[model samples]
Target: MFVIITYDVGEKRVNKVCKKLREYLTWTQNSVFEGEITKSLLMKCLNEIDQIIDEDEDSIYIYEVANPKNIKKQVFGQEKNFDELFL
Candidate 1:
């Protein structure tokens, strides 16, 4: 599946979190990172990431692009361009 993981991380932790994800993600674009990974592995990565993030200032949005029909599965701001597909 195609996974698009976006993060709002503290400036201090952004580099660290990006470093971790770099090991798995590819085809990076701006602050948006994309990769192909399974559900279980993605969850594992997210769990590990949660440990490293500062809850007070950092947040994450992990999108699992599996079922194209499920609009709620989309990450924030993504639906605007995809309204025709899911609306």
Candidate 2:
């Protein structure tokens, strides 16, 4: 599955959440992450995030597509490509 995850987390937990997500997805932009992940991996990722976030103060949104080919994105401004690697 292809997942796009966006989150609004309290300041204190931001780094923890971001770091966890980076392990399973690409950081598409600030507080935004997207990538193809297995169901088990996604579950594990969310479980880790759940442990890091305060349920009362944080929120995470996930959008999923069964097929990656169906994703059609349009960016009006500068686009971020987090998939690039730097050595």
What does candidate 2's lDDT look like per residue over 1-87, in tens digits?
A: 999999999999998999899999999798999999999999999999999999999999999989989888888898886657431
- Residue 82, candidate 2: how far off, in angstroms? 4.2
Report lDDT per candidate: 0.70, 0.92
lDDT of 1 by residue, 22-58 (tens): 6667525445667688778787888889889988888
Model 1 alpha-carbon drift over 4 Å, by segment? 67-87
Model 1, CA-based lDDT:
0.70
Predictions: Cα RMSD each: 8.1, 1.5
Those runs of model 2 whose alpha carbons end farther than 4 Å from true positions after fitting are 82-87
Q: What are the per-model numbers of colliding residue pairs?
A: 0, 0
Query: What's model 2's overall lDDT?
Result: 0.92
Which structure among the candidates has the greatest lDDT? 2
Candidate 2 lDDT at 4 equals 97
Candidate 2 accuracy as TM-score: 0.91
